[model samples]
Target: MSSFLKVLFRNVLNGPSTDPFPLGETFTPDRLRGKVLIDPELCMGCGTCKEVCTAGAIDLSELADGSGFRITVWQNSCCLCASCRHYCPTGAASLIPDWHAAHPEEDKYVRIEQQTVKYEPCSNCGTLMRPIPAKLARKLYASSPELDPEQLRHLCPACRRLRDALKGRPFPVAAAKVPAEAQA
Candidate 1:
C-alpha cells in the first residue's frame, strides 16, 4: 500500500505521459510508414512494386499510345506493408511519414496516386525507350573516365552494348554529340 501510494503521487506530479495528438504537436518518427509515393524520375517501370504489393494496391500499365508507362497506387487498398519500398531496385518507392489518411466515403476512390513516365527516343537508333536514370547511370559507370557516362545514359540497351564492343574505337555513327573533352 505504501509503494502504491508513492507511485500514485509520482504519477500525479509527473502529469500525463501520453502525447496530446490531434490537439497539439506529436512525435513522428523517421521510419514511420504512412503514405506511399513513387518518384517518376527514378522509376524504372519494372512492375516490381505491383508484384510485391500483397494488398494489390499498386497497378502498372503501358499507356495506350505505347510511348510510356503509367503507375498507380490506390491508397484505400494499401495495407502499409512497405513491400514496394523494400523490393524496388531504383529506390523510387517511398513510404513518407504523412499519416493523415482519413477520408470520407465519397473521396475514398478518388484518393489515388498516379504517375506517367514517358519514353525518350534513343540517341543512337531513334527508337522510343526509357533511358537509364542519370543518377543511376553515374553510380554505375562512375569509375570509368574513358566512357562518356552522359552519352551512355541516352542510348538504348542495344546501342549501349555496341558502344561497349567498340572498345575505345571511333563510334560508327554519332549517337549524340560528344563533348569536346570526350572527343579529345
Candidate 2:
C-alpha cells in the first residue's frame, strides 16, 4: 500500500540498516563495567567484597602463616555487578573499562591478589590470625564505647568467645589461668 511504499522509500534513502560487521568500531557505553580491579595495598582482607558479590566470584583465603591474605576473583563467573566495589570500605575495589581476561575455560580466568600484614596474635593462646581491617575496627569501637579496643583487637574470635563464656565463673578453667605451676 502507500504506507508500505513510503517506508520502503525512506529505507532506500537511508542507505544500509546496519553498521559494517566485525571490523566496524563501536563506542563502549558509559558505566560499562568489564572487569574488577583490586588494589592490594588498600585491601585488608575484610571479606566485605566477598559477602556482597552476587555471583560469588570473590574468594578470600587467609595464608597459613597468618602473615597476610589472598583475594581471588573468578572473572569467568563474574556478573560485573560492582557490589564489591561499592561495599569496599577502603575503596580497594573498582570496575575497569577493559575486558576481563580471555580464556578457553571458566577455570582459567582466575585473578589472584595478595596483601601482606602482620597477624594479630591471640593474647591468651598466641594463635595467629588476620586481624579485622582498620576501618572495621574503628567502626566497631565507635558503635560500642564500653568495648576495650586493645582487648578485642588482639584476641581472635575463638579466644574472645572463650573469655566471654568463662567470665565470673567459679571453676578454675585450664585456659582461664596461666597455671602457677607453669609460671614457676
Candidate 3:
C-alpha cells in the first residue's frame, strides 16, 4: 500500500508522460529523424531520392507540365533513414518535424509532395519535356553528331520510342566490311 501511494504521488507530480505536439509544441531530440520536405524549384528530378530510398517510399510520377514530374513520399514506407535527404543534389529534400503526423488509419502516413518545372516542347513531336533541351538532345544522340538538334525536340520516353520505331531506319549492326585485299 505504501509503494502504491508513492507511485500515485509520483504520477500526479510528474504529470503525463505523453508529448503534446502540434497543439502544443513538443521537444525534439537533436538526432531525431523527422518528416521530409521537397522543394520543387530546387529539385532536378534526377531520381536520386528514389534510388537511395531503401524503403521505396519515394515515387516520381508523370505530371502535365511537359518534363515536370510529381514527387510523392509514402510516409508509411519511409524508415526515416535520411538516405534520400543526403543524396538529393539540389538540396530539395530535407527533414522537418511532423508532430501531428499521427492518423487514426494505420495505413496513412505523412507525405510531402511537389512537382518539378516543365521544359519546352520536343522538336519532333512538339511535346513539352525537361527544361534542359540540349541535355535531352545529347541523351538521344551520344555518338552521332549528325543527328539534328531541331529534329530531337522534347519527347517523353514513350513518344521518343514510337518515333524511333516509325522511322524504320535500322541502326548500324556491325562495322563496314573491309576489302579482302586489306586483310593480306
Candidate 4:
C-alpha cells in the first residue's frame, strides 16, 4: 500500500512523461548520425562511398562524357551506418542533424545529382583522370586547368603499362597442377 501511494505521488509530481516529439525540438547530441550529405564537388567518382556503405545506400552512375560520374543517395536504404563517412578520403561525405528527411512518397527518398567538374586528360598519357581527385589536389587546382592533352587518347599511362606487360604473355595457358595442401 505504501509503495503504491509513493508511485501515485511520483507520477502526479512528475506530470506527463511522454515527449511531444515532432511538435517540440528534441535535444540531439553532437556527431549524431542523422542525414548524410555528400559534397559533389569533393567526390572523385571513385565509387568509394558506394563500396564502403554497409547499407548499400549510395549508387554511382557513369556520366555521358565517360570521364565523370554521378552520385545517387537512397535515403530509404540508409541505415546511418557511417561507413561511407569514415572511408571517404576527400571528406566529401558528412552527417548532418536534419533527421526530417522522411517523405510522404517513396520516390521522394532518392536524391541524385551529378558532380560538377572540368574533366581533363592526363598530360603524359591522355587518359582522363580527375585532376583534383584528392582533397589536396582539389585545393591546388580548384580554379585552373593544371594539365595538358585536351583530346581523348586511347592510350593512357596505366593502360599502356598493362598493354606492355601482357605483350609477351601467351594468349592462354593450361592450368597448373594444384598442390595437395592447396586442395579445397
**Candidate 3 lDDT over residue span 1-184, tens digit each:** 9999999999999999888865686787766777777876566678999999999989987676345677888776788898988988667788776645666675365344545555555444444455334544566577778665545544444445655665746423221121112222
lDDT of 4: 0.63
Model 2 C-alpha lDDT per residue in residues 54-138, reported as the tens digit of each score: 9998888877865767788777778999999999987889887776356565556445433445565666656656566555566
The lDDT values for all models are: 0.87, 0.71, 0.65, 0.63
Clashing pairs in 4: none
Ranked by TM-score, top first: 1, 4, 2, 3
Q: Output the lDDT of residue 100, model 4.
A: 66
- Lowest summed lDDT across 10 adjacent residues in model 3 is found at 173-182
With a 3 Å backbone cut-off (N, CA, C), the pairs that clash in candidate 2 are: none
RMSD of 1: 5.8
- Write candidate 1's Cα lDDT for 1-184 as tens digits: 9999999999999999989988999998998989999999999999999999999999999999999999999998999999999999999999999988888898978988899999998777777789989888888988987777789999877767667788767666564433222334
- Let me know the TM-score candidate 2 reaches against the reference structure: 0.53
On residues 42-81, what C-alpha lDDT tens digit does candidate 4 reach at each position? 7766788898888888888777868666687777778988
Clashes of 2: 0
Best-matching candidate per TM-score: 1
* lDDT for position 59 in model 4: 85
What TM-score fits each model?
0.87, 0.53, 0.50, 0.58
Please identify which of the two predictions, 2 or 3, would achieve the higher TM-score against the true structure. Answer: 2
Candidate 1 Cα deviation (angstroms), residue 37: 0.6
